[model samples]
Target: MSARTSAPSWRPANSSGRSLWLAIAGLSPPAIGDSHTGLRLMGDVLSLARRRPFTSAVILLIVAVYVVEIAQSRPAFWLEGKGDLPDIAALGVVWTPAIGDGEWWRLITASSLHAGLLHIALNCYALVVIGGAAEARFRWWRTAVIFLVAAVGGNIAAAAIQPGAASLGASGGVMGLAGAVVVGAVWSGEGLARSQWVIGAIIATVAFGFINPGISNAAHIGGLIAGGAVSLPLGLTARLRRTQRPAPAPKTQARGTAPGRATATGMNPRQVEFQRRIDAAMAKARAEREEDARRASSGE
Candidate 1:
């Protein structure tokens, strides 16, 4: 019998096309065919973390909290769908009644919580993309301010609009970052081509929220508005600073001119006219004094 040949056991199951696409997108390190691909990817992440320390810190904190969440609940809770409400509440998910009862910190804390592994995974990915861009462009402090403000604003809106519903996740803050990017681009006069993809993504996300039940559209809208509002003044200030011109250096005084007077060379029409009037008046006074002196001499 002829010897049979088989495919290598170490090869990945995914099609070459899919693997190639994933590799191109930088989404699958294993597909790159290099044993050190993971190490290279890790190094790249470390480099990005160094450049975006605040974004990295926020992402790390969210991940750490998620780890605690996993420990407190069944494996299925994270892997499949929604977790136990009581467990989630204990872990700081936002509930309107709790906030009403003076557990207001939940508004801020709930943003750091997530509904499931998928939820947190999507959020963290968005955070890495949006937060990193924001930090790179707007500085870490401004990015932090935008994230925190949007989180609180989103929770407040949810509490007001859907009092009976419980909410969790960082979608609001992510949407807020999207809004800030859009508004920031407009104010800074950046090319629309650069931001059109962001705009399309925002529209698609909001549309998806509307289609999907249990999604917090109110919080999303609130966060978008709050983020845009915050970014407006910042963008305006930055644009103003960029466009501002220093006042022309004060014209140097002519060598023979008085300290307060400017040279005619650089003077405007109005200034030149004023200087001419002053000179004419001084000449008239001198002529009058000379005439008086001549008359007095004749009288003597």
Candidate 2:
């Protein structure tokens, strides 16, 4: 009957006592009539869904991606194999840059083009699920970065790895989104550790391989690598791309101040120090969060 005697002395002392006990032990008080932890946890989704702006747009993106792909499937285009570049040329079966140039823009453009209606449909389905979830875990720009980079990476790999091939499909990029979800879940702070997602991705990959005759594994792998890499520092790096700025000068060159040179009218040292601290703190937090996850995974 006593806590000292029982190995598992966790039994509740009836409903009334249990309620009182929880109230006393609660760190954050619960909502009235809502006693379940699952309810509270499900009640908040911003960190998962409702909080992300890019999520809603992603729906449109999904739709648009499929639409364009569907259109490309028609016989009007001159690209071989209905614009399925990888299938046509990855292994040197056929080759040309007819669909989209082997250019950087093609990375994104290919996402909008596909082999057929079914191909587009499958990709959109994957994107909606993966992109929706990715948007939930990562910031909007971060999601955008993974989408862009992964998509580009997939196309690039398709071009490089698949020799003499013209490939078109949202598969590479969308798969990248899936890769982001899987990897981000792996490297997250607290959420997105569902084993189901990983298992599901594996199943989907296998299914895609069996169904789509020319599915380029190269692109899928590349996009995944790109997504994981782009998850860090995507924001500022993106700014440089948009502005087309030349390389960022070293600290000494940016202010036009030589290594040891400064005029009476100089930059604010205090402000600079504060900015440095802010940057350092942010870096530290991100590193700590990642480290905690690493340790937890390693059984440390």
Candidate 3:
């Protein structure tokens, strides 16, 4: 029937595939509440961007570069890949010989360049999930340092491994975020679930490289190691301090008093008043006892 066919038609052909990739990228909806509401999803995305300003800015820059490239008739799609990249080489892409010739800025700039929209989209999506989480955990400056180090490290490694070819894209930085998350979670004593998602993302990214011949596996590996290396000591120190710290002892109450009851010269006004009343009652009782003793001694 039309209804049966309509349901299948409404689904994107690669819906399942995209979902698997998203899960591997740590983009799955949080477990607490699942919703299909567009407005709520948009609001959450905005909130994440606000929390991670640097990450958001990086994503925006990549998108802007891609748009300009497209408008200028560069390789505009996945199918027409890598043809116009050389045209922008002087502008961003990393070439080893160029670095040797003193174009060191390429190490950082190349990471913001992409071969196509598909590449940029994947990296941005990964950034939103992984980078946002990293920023929230490590703060903006640390996250920025990690990303920059990982990106430059990845490019340098790629250049060394394949000096003749040029490398581009935020893949290295994205992988770095993954690596940082994995090691940071483990070192901070975060539970298995936290580490597993990041590990899964790394595996998924590596798998993508094997499937695509042009993808640079070297950059991914280099960035990952660099990120983990940078975050490990920081995470471990924090965990060590937490473990070594002493626990605070509980406050003890006066003997034979009910919970919430006050004592004399206590911190609270109510307790001070209660203590005064108890002191007066004790004094009167002591005086009466003395009078009784005196009477007995006098045989009155």
Candidate 4:
């Protein structure tokens, strides 16, 4: 479920190229793409579903939650949309279980819940795209951890800095994925270049101005940090990932026999091969993350 991944890793930021503003501002938010509109988000998912039945299920998850929220609004199932957008951070904090006042499960629930239909679709699309690329070189477990931390940190940060308002979206985690992938691209010499990275980061930072306030910059920044911090111990040296040959794609098997679906959505064999590859990659990255966490926990 988590598209957050590893095979996509990072290289250290240029410290000497420091910009105090970068520190103060964080990597800017990606253009909430021109295509990104609330209604568009809702429509795009539905449109994609026509060609791919599986994507229907993805939409179902979002609809199911919205249904729950509406039902809760009816004064029955639960108060608020499982949790309010305004209260997401508070819920994650004071209401989160065991730790503060919040339910322990919110850490997980928050990922599933999103700001709105717009939020849900955007993140889902991101998962399919970036995740497709990442899993090719990483591991699932790593994806899960990255998703969890990025989503949780993003929500927490948003709540802390922009408290008293409900907000939900996989964007925080997706943004983390964005940061991780951008770093990965730079390190691996893949999709983008280092100069492009800096430029993209700058544009994103500047676009923050037009983000129309109330968006969670905190969560965005926090997720970026989490991606970077977590990447450090994954053996992601400057040249290691850059010079490496790409990992092979995961091979598929009989329809039901494939360990994982070749294509969760309506996809060609090539697409399936691509997904299998990325999933395999994500799984590998997760293994590394586990080892890294283990090492840190053991003070190794």
Candidate 5:
């Protein structure tokens, strides 16, 4: 059974602009007449980290990769003039020309590559909150698969639209994580009210597309679809597991009898008596027929 969900104490009563900002930052405004705010806020953040190990690890990887990318992307680098990040160019940037030449691995590899500090930070923040919630709800492996599938889908979408343009980042995958949560909720019959947060997250993702110029909306959309595709099956599987019944054991038949025939073993008294009567009748009929045949031969 699913764990019971309740309204979070930290959730604001209304969706004002300030409230939205707080929600994005994963923080709550100071309550009326509350003094232990710092302690409570720290506790919430720590609790989140503890609950989502996979999310934390993914964030760390993104940060580490970004650090390496900045260090390597200098003026001396060969691809430095071509693009901002040399690490992205060397490691894996979704350059359509390269992909056309069979460097298809960029579809997956570009997910870890970022343009700048701002780019990585934004993506990491989304993953930490949205992806962490998803990981907490489902298993670690499912979350990982969803991220990868979304990443590939996003890159493919970008390449299809902008063949010559280069793109890199985890935004596509992050958007996908949000999309999966929303779709999974609907598939599981969690209802609209229960899925409001996920729905809001999708809206926020799309909102970012309009606000940010460099953001790949196509990749975001593709990742969203990919995430939903991967998570839908999990929902169906969970439903089947919940409703599936144990199969009945096979019945044993009597020796020399056809399948579905009454078995010799475990026969009730009435069935045993009936079988005995039928056998006796058959024997008497055979004896009478044999006697009649012998008499007819002798008389002739």
Candidate 6:
């Protein structure tokens, strides 16, 4: 009887091949593809972390603090604006009365705390944009100093202007970064068009604050002023130093001489010409003296 012939099976022939097939079918353990995807995501995060270490750390800290705030209070506190006042105060909101009682640390700490999800979200976004720019321009340490100084300045202004109200968020610091960028651009002679755009953005931001209720215009103003003040001398000194840099000495070449080439006599062209003139003068003087000596001998 003739043997019955069957078509070749599409199944993999080896265990490894079978495992790969099963993984593709979603029936096997976590596949290489999944691991690769995870690795790629981790690499991206690491790249971002390395690009701006201080900025990344600050953002992480803010988010972590917000998470702690959420854990300490009910969800309503972060989701809605109706959180308990005592709970908020405990979380380090800037209360003027508390400052009078010597909670002075709040001047800087309050900048890290937020009132709600929206508050933190807005502030964090601002930090990422403005703070990143400031960090790039002034470097991490200067950026840190600017942020802290602005935060303190803003809180102080708030305490002085609205002593009864409680305030929180990083708006002051963000505004300070914006201010520093503006001043830096101007000092670096970045041109009128760029400077105008930066100035316009600041004006628009301040205007928005004015139109919005419960926003601290005083803090914004104070931060802007403080940032500009801090950056002003730095900018001036940088400009002054740049201007004072000695001009490069002029390149000098020997007269009538081709660059990098010496005369046939192994002297520079200028030296050769000077020697020729000296020899000619000496020969003429010697000839005149000999003629005078001959004339004297004949007269004798």
**TM-score per model over all chains:** 0.69, 0.49, 0.67, 0.47, 0.63, 0.64
lDDT of 2: 0.52
- Candidates in order have lDDT scores of 0.68, 0.52, 0.69, 0.48, 0.66, 0.67
Q: Which candidate would rank higher by TM-score, 1 or 4?
A: 1
Candidate ranking under TM-score, highest first, comes to 1, 3, 6, 5, 2, 4
Query: Candidate 4, which ten residues in sequence have the lowest lDDT sum?
Result: 9-18
Ten contiguous residues minimizing lDDT sum, candidate 5: 9-18
Writing each residue's lDDT as its tens digit, candidate 6 over 116-235 gives 676776666566557777787777877888888887898788778766567677777777777998889877877546545446656766776666545676777888888877877766
- Deviation from native of the Cα of residue 145 in model 2, angstroms: 0.6
Q: What are the per-residue Cα lDDT tens digits for candidate 3 across 66-88? A: 76656554443332443543445
lDDT of 5 by residue, 1-300 (tens): 101112111110100111232365455457857789888878866876688777877887877876776677653322222233333466787777788889999888788876544455556667767787688656677788888888899889877865545667787787678777787777777766765766776777667565654456678788888888887886577668767967877766654333443653667556766776787788899999999999999995
lDDT (Cα) of model 5: 0.66
Any idea what lDDT model 1 has? 0.68
The CA lDDT at 297 in model 6 is: 94
| Tens digit of per-residue lDDT, candidate 2, span 1-300 | 101112221110000111111222223445666668567666643443566566556545656655543444434222222333322222221122532443445555655554444454455455545667677666577888788888778767766766444455655655666666666655544455473554466445645454554566667767777876776555345444557967766444224233433333354666555655776788899999999999999999
Arrange candidates, best lDDT first. 3, 1, 6, 5, 2, 4
Kindly give the number of clashing pairs for every candidate. Answer: 0, 5, 0, 40, 0, 0
TM-score (C-alpha, index-matched) for candidate 3: 0.67
Show model 6 residue runs off by greater than 4 Å: 1-46, 195-197, 236-300
Task: Provide the lDDT at 187 for model 3.
Answer: 66
Q: Please write out the lDDT profile of model 1 over residues 148-236, one tens digit for every residue.
A: 88878887887787676677678688777778888888877776667765576566666656765557777777777888788787767
Residue pairs clashing, model 2:
85-166, 85-167, 85-168, 86-167, 89-165
Highest TM-score, which number? 1
Model 2 weakest 10-residue run by lDDT: 9-18
